[model samples]
Target: MPSVTTPPADSLLQHRAFVAFWFARIASGFGFQMLSVAVGWQIYAVTGRAFDLGLIGLVQFVPSLLLALPAGHVADQFERRRIVLLGQVVEWIAIALLTGMSLAHGIHEVGILLLVCVIGIAKAFEFPALQSMLPALVPAAILPRAMAVSASAGQAAMIMGPALGGFLYVAGPGVVYSVCGALYLVSVALMGRLHYEQAPPKREPATLRTLFAGVHFIRARKDVLGVISLDLFAVLLGGATALLPIFARDILHTGPWGLGLLRAAPAVGALLMSVWLARHSLQQRVGTIMFAAVAGFGVATLVFAVSTTLWLSLAALFALGAFDMVSMVIRGALVQLETPDDMRGRVSAVNAIFINTSNQLGEFESGMLAAWVGAVSATVIGGIGTLAVVGLWMGMFPTLRQRQRLHVEAAAPADTR
Candidate 1:
């Protein structure tokens, strides 16, 4: 066998395949972020209903919940690049539909919600393929640095996409959707440049046993289950981003531009932290740091919930992102390093389910709660709930709490079983 040498951390950018994949992430991230801002603004502008805002999250959540297992199976069986390309094609078509609706001056709440569901279905299929592709692209020794770089690029796009969306929205929703569609096309071109040779998959007949493999894999590992579940419930309770439109219009007394700034603030903080982590790896006391960071995220949410001043609220959001970034990096590294290659697609699908539940379902939960109580009161209560979850998880998962490093010895296939 030919010898394999690990690439130096600083030299990750020199690899052409990784660089292509990175740009693809940048394009897709920016388009999706911009599309989100446009959809939220358009929906709220037309209906002026908080329930409809929550409905947007619900519509998107349905496809992911329904298709996650099947999608994971497909990723393992097929060429991942083709799966991603097909998803982009679906996304492009959805964007085209939105743009046409915008141009016709017939943008309806139901139409926007339906298109978002279509996009969500496409995302459900694409996520596992994209996530599992990373480990194959870079050597294990530099995986942490590569992940940090990818996240930073994503954060940078998040910061730019919303602000650009807001600026273009002044012209009309048509402009924003048009720009988003163009970006999706650019992403397709970038994705085509990637060259990944997938290993032959283990041959197994379709069965219930094979489908549930990812769940069983996660359940057997206490550390993976602890971190994944911790993030799931914590973010489910603490999510406040779903209410930004209300905050911007009613509480903060700001317009679309202000809403854009509010959305971008968290990414700004995350981007800065990602850059730092890329330079300095979190090699020690990772579990302890992750726990503390989550607790801090809860406190920051509380501060944001009660703040009356814009500057103070922005500061609170920045702090919230900074803390969340630390937890994200640690959890992400653990997920990538601990799973066996053959099971990566399935495992990543499980992770995606946890994340989507926290984000989209959490948005629905926030909206429903905000409608019951006032938005401010709902947020304050959710933050407290997050803190409560942290305390409970720490007590329950002592092994996870005691974990000292991000690195884990690769388990034998039989050991995973």
Candidate 2:
């Protein structure tokens, strides 16, 4: 295994393409966060139902599951920059429509739901394109650093976006959507500045056949499938994010600000950990670290479920988020290091589908369970399930645990390797 080295924080900043990509991601992520908060608050405020919030996740996940494969194929075949721009354009349009409805004071629950679906469709395309384009911007040696920096910026935006969205909605319901639209436009402009070395299209046909090839690639590699499956189940069972509003309103007895904090706490923790890991590279013990982190997440979630105080709840969420980031870093590094350069886009797309399904399914499960058994039980049960996932993955996929440092040197393109 080749030794992994930490790049200077300024490496990505020095590259124009990377800078542009990072800026665009930050802006878009911020806007998306704000939009999510607004939608949740609006829907709950109107319907007075926890299940309504779950539907939001369902809408987003459905499109991602349905379109992500084709989007990945397109990302592989088309110029990545162009695919990114087109997705951004669609996002901007969706936001614009939402803004117009808000300004007209004609915003209805149904209208907002439709808008949410439109945003979901945009995301279905945007995510794969963005992930695929990363390798084109930075050297293989510095990709981890770039990813860390990007994740930090996105998390920071998440911290501000929700709180700001809640406050702005109080001032005027239209503020959130308007800001979201403007951010989308800015993202489009930022993406315009990126450059890519164009590659000829793959000889493989763009159909279900090619899409399944990505699945085959994962199945063929034990290590890759192991990492992916671990995350899939862990996130599927452990994700209690969508039910935060109920905890905020009923259990914590805090309002929108508390809700925002609850949502942001995990990302804030993740951001801090990501920064530390990026600065001091975690080359060896990658698998062990990921397992420990996920287990930590389960423990944190368990504590949060039982906590009565807002501060305790916040702390638990923070811990969960931080550990979750560790898992994300390890799994992401695994994917980047293991995947062939030619199939990165499709493989990422397939991964996206699994992740999306798990996340949305988790939200649905939490909501239904909460409705059936009560909120506290729902969270506790989910946490227990997450712990079980961790144990099972560890026992089942020894390759992930047995494997040591990433073969970064071997991952390089032929001549470089």
lDDT of 2 by residue, 1-417 (tens): 232465665656778888888788888988898889888987888789899898897788788888888888877777778887888888788778877877887777888888889878878887877887776677766666667777787888878877788788886667888988888888888888767775776756777788777899899888789888888888877777878998999998999889878887898898898788667666677778878888999999899999989999999999999998888877776786677667778888998988877786778788999999988999999899989988888888886876666545345547431
Give the residue spans of candidate 2 off by over 4 A. 1-4, 39-56, 105-112, 242-260, 370-378, 407-417
Cα lDDT listed for each candidate: 0.85, 0.81
lDDT, candidate 1, 203-270, per-residue tens? 67657777789999999988899999999998999899889889989999999888877887888888
For lDDT, the strongest prediction is 1
Task: State residue 336's C-alpha deviation in candidate 1, in Å.
Answer: 1.7
